[model samples]
Target: MSLVPTVHLPDDLAAALTRRLAATAPTEASAQVDRLIENYRGATPTAAPVLRDAGDAAAYAAYRMPATYAAARSALAELRARTGAWTPRAHLDLGGGTGAARWAVADTWPGESGPRGTVLDWSAAALDLGRALAADASAPSVRATTWTRAPLSGAPELPAADLVTVSYVLGELTPGDRASLVDAAAGAARAGGVVLVAEPGTPEGYARVIAARGRLVAAGFRVLAPCPHSGPCPVTGTDWCHFAARVPRSALHRQVKGGTLPYEDEKFSYVAAVRPDGAGTPPAPAANRVVRHPQTRKGQVLLDLCAAAGDLTRTTVTKRHGPLYRAARDARWGAPWPPDDQPDGVPDSGGPDREGAV
Candidate 1:
């Protein structure tokens, strides 16, 4: 249940980024890299431009692409494990950057041939860069990706797709625009198809995801992950639901971002929902969700669990539990808690915010 995807910035893309950085003086490239970091920290739809030129775009690929790919990859794994043998034939990415979601999909969807996918974004440079990066990708889906330039707010109607992704792009939009983007994504999906949305793991990011979830539920889609029974998000108070994906960064990543952590944990909140008509049958549920990492101590392990009975509580496993204690000891962040257990009745993780069948 703990899915950690292997992400290396694609070879062709890495060469391009290196060339772009080399084209600039070291100081200039570093400054552009610095700006990418700063603008990313402060950017909104109307903010100062971030991905302006080759160097700017390269810096973006360096600092952001790995984490973006990791989050989407993790969410897709969770959805697929539940759905079983489902493979999307067509994909549409609204405001997808550098086609990261396409790569994530190519990794998870288990088709003999990859799906056809399109990436729509406002940055012509980003689209162009996306193409170069994916131009000779090994995955047919990434190679077949079409990058289109479109305004996020007033983009044209989307093509119907088997899978749709809107990742890390909602925070840049206004409230109205976020809702509109969600509507467009929801409308574009075929019945029983999936729509995956990911954002930063901050409280505000979770708030945006919560709003989008409401939109999806109202639009007749059912929650697929992070909730066993979607009656309501049973998690209340200041804590919000989110997940983490750890990804390895390349040498270029160190150069652009400075310092040297070989990897970074990308924290994100995502909702994967299926349109009622197309979702097929619901899968059997995991009995508990590991809402927090297990705390291992001498002869005992402590776990924060969201149970099948609709409660979030702490469970202590001592050496007496043997295998169970070892399993709890080795459990990772964002995995199904005690994966083998089956729920007897309804399941709940968050509180008072959603409604679905038990």
Candidate 2:
């Protein structure tokens, strides 16, 4: 079952971060944020820790964790929906500074005692802040997290777990390290294990996600979201596949970003891959995915879809088709097509392409 969408940070985490930010001089915190932004935008692999000190870690947790948490929540939501009845008992968050992905996981699978989490990162400061914040978390999984200081180099073999997530960390790695990390992530998937990789929505981030997707597929895993088929991505040229998660900003967030908007949309690209369980089969993915926002015109709705046939196609539904038209109007971007109705996989009417009809 999918959990409710998380638009803001959990109250406990938010309060803890605010307290930490308050302890630091506002100027110092803002400066730390600026430096982190520059480093992240540079997207260069660093030989040393990015969050070099407690101030840097605290500022980052206050400034970026909400967006990272929201993006991870959205990606994991897709994984949950795609993998029916499959629940993770243990999770490993690779390069998971401050355990943002772990927070998302707790929300995704609430009330379950298991899915005990481990957050591994090279930055001791980040891990320390993360541990402090999680100590008061609402989820047992978050509170019981094992905060470990580990480097993401050498493509070291990882411990097998039910779930592994690599979020927003690929950009900081050299090309060789990035591939090695993806390989390690692939190898970490055990019986029915799932791997999720997320990156910024930038072109560079999309390239990283695509490369990881190829590696997972080659490793005998089945893709479960965004892509309806495991074949080559139909998205070509400059167009990239990405999704947006809206995060509510705190006052501190506004001060750091100099933005007045109460919420911001975090654009991210991701892929969720899974291995077969004891049944020796995986759940079926959607027949098609709404790759972009649905466009509604005077009398028709246009849906840009990644169809099950492993190709990009446009489906148009007009007023002539009453029910389907309404569904198309309500359809959201990044959701499966046909609106989960018509479970038989046939629409009320469609053209020869079988995408949709008037």
Query: lDDT per prediction?
Result: 0.74, 0.84
C-alpha RMSD for every candidate = 5.1, 3.2
Number of the top-ranking candidate, with TM-score as the measure: 2
**Candidate 1 minimal-lDDT segment of 10 residues:** 349-358
> Please, what's the RMSD in Å of model 2?
3.2
Candidate 1 lDDT score at position 134: 82
lDDT by residue for model 1 (95-175), tens:
886878888888787455887899998887777778877865677678889898888785358889988999998988889
Candidate 1's TM-score: 0.85
Superposed model 2: Cα runs more than 4 Å off:
1-6, 112-114, 278-281, 348-358
Per-prediction TM-score to the true structure, in the order listed:
0.85, 0.93
Q: List the residue pairs that clash in candidate 2.
A: 89-115
